[model samples]
Target: MIKVETGLADFDIGSETQDVARHGGGAIASFVGLVRDDGNLQSLELEHYPAMTQKALYGIAEIAKADWALHAVTIIHRVGKLAVGENIVLVVTGSDHRKAAIEACSFIMDRLKTVAPFWKKEVRLDGTDQWVEERQSDIDASKQWDE
Candidate 1:
């Protein structure tokens, strides 16, 4: 089972976890990214072309499924404006073994952060806004998988 989706609505983590678990995987691992409340932050606005975003997300999930021999993989990325502390994305990976499930979850998230075609802007409480830049830390994290 492989599920990839992008939209403005929030997702239910419980249902997602259950859906992956039902696929007969012995181990399941998941990650949920949330909008951080930096002192100046009011909200985060996310944008992406629908076709490109779906294709990219599906491609990443497929790679994880093949490389890790996963039984199931799920990725959900939310777009549009989101309030502080809202869920931004969810990644779940399930496999026969713990190591594969855990690592694949991390792998998918790393790729999503660096490769997914979503643009983000931060709106400050003071009414100022700025586009978010890719951080060196994120680039470095994604590079480790290439080694």
Candidate 2:
């Protein structure tokens, strides 16, 4: 099972975990990203082309599933304005063992950081806004999975 969702609504982590557990995998690993209060930022806004974003997210999940033989994969990302400390994204991977479950979740998140089409802007408390640039560290992490 592979599920992908993008919206403004916050996801229920408990429910998502239960759903993945029902798939009868031996282990399930998850990653949750939350908005940070960096640089005196007030809030963050994420913009994306809906259709394209969905396709990209699904593609990332599919690759992880194939490589890990995962029993289940779930990815949820929020768009639009998000307050500091709010949930930004969630990724869950289930497999017959712990290593695949853990590694697949990391791979999905690393790839999403580099491959997802979302545009992020930092809204500062000082009445300034700036577009976020992709970090070199993220690119390197994603490439590690390919090798």
Candidate 3:
């Protein structure tokens, strides 16, 4: 199963993954990405298109399922005004082996960075906001999976 949500509350995918893996699989690999303080940013806000974001995430989840023996997958990306310490994203993938679970988790995150429609604005110390750009490295990383 694949789920995606955008809201103000935090997300927890590790517990869900563990529960699904208890009887259905071997390992549960999870990753949590948080907004950084960095002493240079005060506030951060994430923006994402409603229908399109969910569709892209589900597509990524399907790709993972096709490439691995995935038992379950969950992804949650929070939007709206957020503090420096808030959580940004959560991803969990389960499989029959550690290697597959770990690799799939990495694959999901890499794809999310490049292909996901989420946009972020970082508030600097001087109170200026800047839109985060998609880096060339991010594009290159996604292409590695294709080759």
Candidate 4:
């Protein structure tokens, strides 16, 4: 399952995990990204090119599936305005073993941070806004997966 939208995620992590676990998977790993209240942070706004974003996510999922013996993969990313503690992204990977499930989950997230066609703007508590910059650490993390 893959979804990209501008609405609330409202996902049930346990149910989603069960959905994947039924597919012969012995292990499930998940990641949920939330808007952090970093003192001055108020809210976050996310934007993405409709078709491009979905394609990028699907592409990442496909790569993970190929690299691991994954039975299922789910990625849900939220757009629009999100208050502190709101969900931003979700990644779930299922496999027959813990190592595969965990590695694939991490792989997808690392690639998503650097490769996904999404932009984020931070709205500060002081009524200031700025586009979030990509961190060098993210770039370095993604590089480890390069062939």
Candidate 5:
């Protein structure tokens, strides 16, 4: 099972992800991406194309399932004005082995950065904001898993 949301609330994906992995008695790994207080921005507002965002996330989940012995996965990304120190994204991967769970989590995050149709607009400290563009590094990260 997978759950995705765009609300501004803290999530508990680890426990849920662990449950899925534990169904068969194995390992689970998760990641929580938080907003940074870097000089580049004072705040971040995320806007996503609803339908496309869900589709892309599911696609990433499929890739993880095919590549690893995963039992369950969950990915949640918040969209809206998010202040620093808030959670931006969460990913959970379950598998029989620690390595599998860990690797799958990394793989999911790397691909999501590029594959997901999530646009981030950063509000600068100087009261200016700009939309972020897809970077080549993001594309390169996803390529590592290509068959």
Candidate 6:
């Protein structure tokens, strides 16, 4: 299963994890990304092209599923105004072995960070808003899977 959501709704990680774990897999790996308080960020507003974002997410999941023996995959990303320490993204992967599940989860996150068409705007405590730039580290992380 592949899911891509962009809204103000907060994801329930435990329920999602349980759903994946019940897919007859021995191991389930998950990752949850949260908005950081760095730079005195007051809130984050995420924008994306709805159709394109969902397509990109599904594409990434497909790649992981093909490369690994994954039984299930779930990805939920929240949009709109998110305060610091709020959940931003959730990724879960289930497989028969821990190695495959772990690698697939990591691969999905790395690819999503770079490949997904989501734009982030950071609102600082001083009431200043700036578009966030993608870090070179994220690009490098995604590139590792190419080899």
For model 3, how does the per-residue alpha-carbon lDDT over 73-142 read when each residue is reduced to its tens digit?
A: 8888898988888889988888889999899999999999988889999988798999988899989988
Worst 10 residues of 2 by lDDT: 17-26
RMSD in angstroms between candidate 1 and the native structure over all alpha carbons: 0.7
lDDT over C-alpha atoms for residue 26 of model 1 = 96
User: Estimated TM-score per prediction?
Assistant: 0.98, 0.98, 0.92, 0.93, 0.88, 0.96
What TM-score does prediction 6 earn? 0.96
lDDT of each: 0.95, 0.94, 0.85, 0.86, 0.82, 0.92
Candidates by lDDT, descending order: 1, 2, 6, 4, 3, 5
Which is superior by lDDT, 1 or 4? Answer: 1
Q: Report how far residue 79 has shifted in candidate 4, in Å.
A: 0.5
Q: What is the C-alpha lDDT profile of model 4 across 1-147, one tens digit per residue?
A: 443333455677787778777777689899999999999999999988787888889999998988897888988888889999988888889898999999999999999999988899999999999999999999999999885
Off by over 4 Å in 3: none
lDDT of 2: 0.94
* Model 1 agreement with the true structure over 14-116: per-residue lDDT tens digits: 9999999999869999999999988889999999988789889999999999999999999999999999999999999989999999999999999999998
Candidate 2: lDDT of 95? Answer: 95
- Cα lDDT tens digits for candidate 5, 85-112: 8889999887789998899999999989
Q: Write one digit per residue (lDDT tens) for candidate 6, span 15-132.
A: 9999888888799999999999896899999998897998999999999988998999999999899999999999999999999999999999999999888999999999999999
Cα-based RMSD of candidate 4: 1.7
